[model samples]
Target chain A: MTTGFGLNNLPYGVFSTPGTAPRVGVRFGDQVLDLAAALNDPVFASPSLNPFMAQGRARWTEVRARIPAALENGPLHPLTGVHLHMPFEVADYVDFYASEEHATNLGRMFRPDSAPLLPNWKHLPVGYHGRAGTVVPSGTGIVRPSGQRKPPNQRTPDHGPSRRLDVEVEVGFVVGSPSPLGQPIPTSAFADHVFGVCLVNDWSARDIQAWEYVPLGPFLGKSFATSISPWIVPLDALTEARVPTPPQDPAPLPYLTDAEPWGLDLSLTLSLNGHALSHPPYASMYWSPAQMLAHMTVNGASVRTGDLYASGTVSGPDASQRGSFIELTWGGENPLKLHDGSTRTFLEDGDEVTITATAPGTNGEAISFGEVKGRILPIQ
Target chain B: MTTGFGLNNLPYGVFSTPGTAPRVGVRFGDQVLDLAAALNDPVFASPSLNPFMAQGRARWTEVRARIPAALENGPLHPLTGVHLHMPFEVADYVDFYASEEHATNLGRMFRPDSAPLLPNWKHLPVGYHGRAGTVVPSGTGIVRPSGQRKPPNQRTPDHGPSRRLDVEVEVGFVVGSPSPLGQPIPTSAFADHVFGVCLVNDWSARDIQAWEYVPLGPFLGKSFATSISPWIVPLDALTEARVPTPPQDPAPLPYLTDAEPWGLDLSLTLSLNGHALSHPPYASMYWSPAQMLAHMTVNGASVRTGDLYASGTVSGPDASQRGSFIELTWGGENPLKLHDGSTRTFLEDGDEVTITATAPGTNGEAISFGEVKGRILPIQ
Candidate 1:
């Protein structure tokens, strides 16, 4: 009876015990094996995984393979006693609108008169740069952001706390090895450069976004806070989870076309308070993570070791499988009824949202990808 | 007579002589003064200004006041043999469309039927995040970015080198002091948090931008390479250059309203090859830097020590004072004749652009903001 932490899955994280500085640790059945003390490697002594991740693919493979034997003889601490931090120092964060369902849902609500999907949506993956400084670790309290929000009927905008605060369930890819300034990382080089995968909750203020996202993408609406799961599930751990993505129409350019399927067969669940609201299947995603990376760098934009890019809002075709409240509730026109007989159009104060995921492990076992949890607090 | 690098305006940078690692230095009259050797402080021994900048305003003030005496006794190296690196590691790079003239010009050309300025333009400082990893130091060659670009007449998009490469002459503000998460930095705290200003040339690919920038803001269109001058002119040195900005038609929000006017009166010159083109006046900008900083953080987004935010293309009322080539050429409808009697709609291969600025110093002397220069190279 493996609790999803068998030898097949060893996610990396930064943890600290009482009076001890934060350092690298590997998760094993309810316990964290300190990598620095177990392997006696100084690379794991740093707070961030950047130093070790920068050692490239070969080093990551060696360390991942070595962790199992080291766990047999090393001292371990229970997960409850350790405080986990941001696994890596984020370099640059780019969010891609790769979910066909989510993009179509948003386009229908935002632009009712026009076509559901934009002209360029099918041809290329649309992505934009996001605030890297505001990316916090999971369990960090989300402060309700205050900004300018104007409804359609309102003549002028009002400045106050955002009324429609929501969460976007996403899968974030982190870069380990960096590419040169003018070099484009091809789709074939995705696994070579991408270190691992983690869950992300891209908190958004819908009202602020609608009013301001015309010429510019998103600013204050999304920049306030973004939370990520503490543990990083290495790409090497998910070999059994590889699946084919939903077929793309009008095949992408040669630069973005991947010869092999790069989709992960992970299942994601979103919970509000303690009730499970939706399960957005990652297999239903339109674009693969490899294609997103290729499209991002095809223009010769370099990526750093800690660079993070997220698959924007994982949503399925069904209404119950929507990833964001905006899509699930149909842009606040329909309210979702909670398990406690309460209704929600969007998140309110003290609303806790947690997103968790799991994928197929070796020998028909399951591997957990940890969880990203956050509680909303009223404006300070 | 001082050549802009006077006693009153000693800007900070990082430079390295042959066989020596890069370290902190100050520009003083065509020579680089080593701060680590002069002050005998380890903070000045860092390769980037982030360490010293993180020490906050009081330390920065003390160091600025002590530089004159240190210059009198310290050994100086002529600037010719020194190679200047990126002064600081950019945390999050943001570009704000604060220029009324520039925004209106783009709006008029892009959306011909609608109102020039968006309804929300006057209410807030519209900005978006840019790739920090690709922000290169001045003199770095910019490779022509190739991406998916669909011209208006074409049925489908074509993937190739961008035909409409351009440059945006702007001023960049570097943040020295970081604000805590969820704590909004008021307009009055701008000078306390912002360390200095420098010249920035935000390279752009106009053709790719036109197709992809529908729902989302600019991405690869502007992410290839952003060039910044090596030297950072401290905010304290620009005291004499303060002026009143143009009046706002509608009063701004209380958070954006500054008690003291923070408008800078710097004169900027843009050159192509060796011909002087336009002179963009920073004083003509609609939004002040303080307001931009205040607006950016009002939503509880935290700022880091090395965050950089730029005033978008600083175009004045007249056509001759336009900052970006898109506006100067009216979106390629008009061509600008150079000194060689050659007309250009957009930047061609091997075209070099240099942007320089100057502000009033003490005793009627001029202080330089240095120059950000870059040459375009054909795609590899």
Candidate 2:
């Protein structure tokens, strides 16, 4: 169990003791090593990880390497005694539809009459900017979002709490380094810029999305509250998890192509009220993270430190590997049976959803990506 | 001419002299009154207007009232020698299709066989989030964005500079005060939350937009650069411009309705290379700014101090009042004759697009929203 948080998987996060202010810390098994106290540095004193995240890749690597040695002789605090917060301030949040299986499933379910995949889906990675202010840390209770929803039978929209709420199990990439405007970062340069990865539960209102998503993309449908894991597993720790992406039939453009494989073989598990629901394989994504980053910046949009972009619902080829409740329950037509003898179509008030993942470490052990858990609360 | 920047329009901005640090300033006739020096306070000393904007409506009103009296004896700097910067840090950038003409024209042009408006357009203010980090201030040169674009004849998308580049003349409302995440702000509270307004040039890549905007909305196509005016004209100054919004045909939901008129009667002019192209009437917008704000936050998205939401292309009923080149030239089918004897369907490399607007003042004078201008530079 201690090997799950081995030396190779020293993830950074912000934590605070009962009476102390928030400070940077690194997880070591069930304890947290206080990096600020260990180094006696003011750089890690900030409540958020933004100040340290802005130091770029060189500093991030240096600090990560130094953390293991510091923990051997430095102060340690029990994880139970400290409260973990949102690791870093999200500069901009972008959600990308990268999973071919998930996109195809959604298209087939939503638009049964038309072709499952859109014309441009094979050519480019489809993505949209999401609300950054509402991105909450793991364990934050998500309030049932109330908004305009148009049922299939109704001609007009009605104002009420969302009936079809869903969660997308995603792997979020945080940008540690900044790129200048009017410059495009190539697919090969992804490792030089991206900081780390974390699990994200992109809470969505399917009813609002169905009604409002027309000329524009998702807005209020997904902006209410997006929960992200507290621990950010650095890219350096996932060296063994790198796998090859699925082959493209038409082949991508030169800008979106990379000679090396960039996919990660992380196994993710989604649970509802302590019962395991489905397993979403991260390696099965059609579009690689590097390709997404390359396509995002190809048009000269600058990258800022703490900028977060998530791989849209990670689902594999099989039905058991579906990442979202919408897919598992087939848009509420099918209800999933849990271990507790309860059936769920969508998350109900007071029901808790937890997503956990693990990847193979260099030493043939499992490296966990802590948990991104959230309980849904009724409309206040 | 001087009445345009008279006592009625004291737009706030960030400016700096040759050797001084950036500070908040207000534009008077041909000079800038240093607000920090005028008030002798540290709150106005920040580089951006975010600090001042976060002070809320009461403080905003107090500062506006004292500016004129303090300017008579306060420190002044010549506008020629001062460098103006982004007035406020953009928290999030949302573009809304509030103009019926713009939406209908786009609908007809893009989907010739379909209805002029989408089914949900009448019931809701259609909007999507744009890249916030790439939002630049006025006078910033917009680099011709290069990306994957598919021509009508091409089977695959070709990676290159955008062939069809255009500008959307829009009015941006800046949120000064913020409401709770789960609570909806009513249209009646618009004055209490919105600090001011500015002009925005939503630079667009029509070809890229057409290709990528299907399942999801516009991404890289409209993300490269969005230029906003340096000065932010306070809403208090535009009291006389408040007019009744155009009649909503189907009638809005109760949450979207406003007891008082919230539309502004501002006249906007779009000029290319000094040749006037169109005059989009802001008062003709089908959905008011207040309604847009209400719809945006109704789904529980929290408003930040510097959040910017723009009224999408303010095209009126007639072709002469179009807001974008796409509408004026009818998607490159017809070219416009310029003063230099040049025919242009879309923006050229050296083309300079300037958007200026003036709203009715309380005492019959004109209140100007200082121009937002940008020159197009070829892809670097």
Best by the DockQ measure: 1
If chain B of candidate 1 is superposed on the true chain B, what is its TM-score?
0.99
Model 2 per-residue lDDT at B57: 88
Question: Which CAPRI level is candidate 1?
Answer: high
Among all windows of 10 consecutive residues in model 2 chain B, the one with the lowest summed lDDT is B1-10
Candidate 2: deviation at residue A197, Å? 0.4
Residue A203, model 2, lDDT: 96
Model 2 lDDT tens row, B1-380: 35588888899999999899999999988889999988999989999999888888899999999988988997988889899999999988899999999999999999999999999998989999998999999999899999989988998889999999999999999998877877788888998889999999999999999999988899998999999999999989989999999889889999999768999999999999887899999999999999999999898788998999999999999999999999999999999988888899999998999999999986788988889999999888
On lDDT, the leading prediction is 1
Per-candidate TM-scores read: 0.99, 0.99
- The global C-alpha lDDT for each of the candidates, from Candidate 1 onward, is 0.93, 0.92
Quote the lDDT for B355 in model 2. Answer: 98
Alpha-carbon lDDT of model 1 = 0.93
